[model samples]
Target: VQESEIGTAPDKTSTAFIPKQNEQNVLNDILSSLHLTPMDVYAADNTCAAGSKLTERHTFFPPFLNSSVARTKTLVHISELSKLHSAKRVVSDETFQDLCDSIESTGIYLYTPIYDSVNPRMPLPLRYECRQFPRASGYVEDPATGIAAAALACSLRKHNQRYFETNNDIVPHHEHTNSYDRFEFYQGTAMGRPSKITIRFVENKDQHCDDTTAVKRTTTRMLCSGLV
Candidate 1:
C-alpha cells in the first residue's frame, strides 16, 4: 500500500499474508444445499440443473469454489448482496443441514460487485457476506474476514480470465486488465457488525501452450485497518 493512499493516520495499521492455494472439490457435494449447480453443465443432474436455472434467471453465475487462508469457501456470485436474504426462503433447513454434514468447508461466502450502483467512470469494489456454516461450529457469521476477502479477490480475477477464452464475459472491462486491482469487501451488515476489508493484487500472465491469452497466476496482498 502506498503511504499517500493510506494518509497520515496514526491509529490505523496494516498486515499482509500469503494465502495458501488449494484444490477444493467439496463444492460438488454441497451444491444442492447451497442451491447451486456445478460450473460444468455435464456435471449437473436434474436437481442441480434446477438450481443452476434459478441462478441464471436471477443473473448469478455459478458459484466459484476456492480455499481461503483458513478454510474452503464456496463463493456464490449474486447480482446484489441484498438478494441473499430472499435466497434463504428457497434453501430449506433440511437441505442446509445436509450441506453442513456433506462438506468440509467453513462456510459459503456470498459476494457481488457494487459497481453498478456506483459511477461506472470510477473503479469499484466488491462486497461479501461471510456466513460461516461449519458442521457443529455453532458460528453463524464473521464480523470481519480479511483473509477471506483476499482469497475472493484473487479467485474472481482468475474466474474472469477462464471465461474470456470461451467468450463468456461476466465481469466488467476494467477487471479484465492484468494490472493491480483493488477491492473492498463489506461484510457483517446482516448481523449488525458491519465491517470492511480491502485487498489489492496484480495478475501475472502466463502464455498457454497454444499461445492463447490468459492469466495463469496472481500475486495477492491485503491491506486492512486493524482487521485480520
Candidate 2:
C-alpha cells in the first residue's frame, strides 16, 4: 500500500489513504458472494475523450460452467452526475433508482464528478454509486468502493490529457495544461455511512524539450488517501 498527505491549510489537519493489495482475490470474493463468476479484469482504456459520456458493457460466465452456460452482464456508465447543494440531499430518488435499474449486473458502478450546485461549472469532488442485485442476496447499494473510485480517477486523468491535445483552440499554450488533477470523493451518503476519498495525480514532464512541444511523454503518478 502507498500513502500520501493532503491538506488545504498550513496548520490544518491532513488526511491520507493507503491502497489495498490482493485486488484480484477481493474482486473474486465479491463476485462469488453475488453468485457470479469473475472474468478477465483489465484496467479501463483511454477510449473516450474528455467530458464525453459513454457506457461500456461486459459479460462473464459462471466459474464452473463453459461459455455456453449462463453469463452475468454488467454495465458501467461514465457521465457528469448532477450536483448536490447539501450532503443531506445527495441524490434525487427517481434518478438514483432509475440508474440502478438501467443495467443488470453482479454490481453496477456509476462514475460522476460532483459539482457545486451554486456554481455548476466548478467541480467539488468525484463520486461513484454502486448497486447490486442477485438471486439470493436481493438488491443493495454499496456504501463505498475504493477500487471503483480509483478506476474513475485513472480514467479522468487520461481523458483530460486527450481533451487538451484535441482542443487546442481552448487551451492555446502547451504550458497551460490541466497537468495536476485532484478528486475528492463523497460516497455512502445515501446509506447514511458517508465516506471521503481523495485522489491526486501529478504529471512528470520529460527533461528534454525542443521548440516543437512544450512537454512530451508526460507520465503520471496517482496518490489516493481515504477509507474504501
Q: Which of the numbered candidates is closest to the native, going by highest TM-score?
A: 1
- TM-score for candidate 1: 0.50
Q: Evaluate model 2: give its lDDT.
A: 0.36
Provide the TM-score for each candidate, comma-separated.
Answer: 0.50, 0.41
Q: Report the lDDT tens digits of candidate 2 across residue range 1-228.
A: 111111111111211111134333433443333333322211122122222121111011011110101222232232222311111212344433443233222233333333334433321222333322221223355556555456545554444445444544232122312223766666666557777767677778776667885655777777778874
| Candidate 1 minimal-lDDT segment of 10 residues | 1-10
Cα lDDT listed for each candidate: 0.44, 0.36
lDDT of 1 by residue, 53-170 (tens): 3222222123344456555654555443455433321355555555644444456666655533343332223334443333334454565766566667666555445444345534
Q: lDDT, candidate 1, residue 167? A: 52
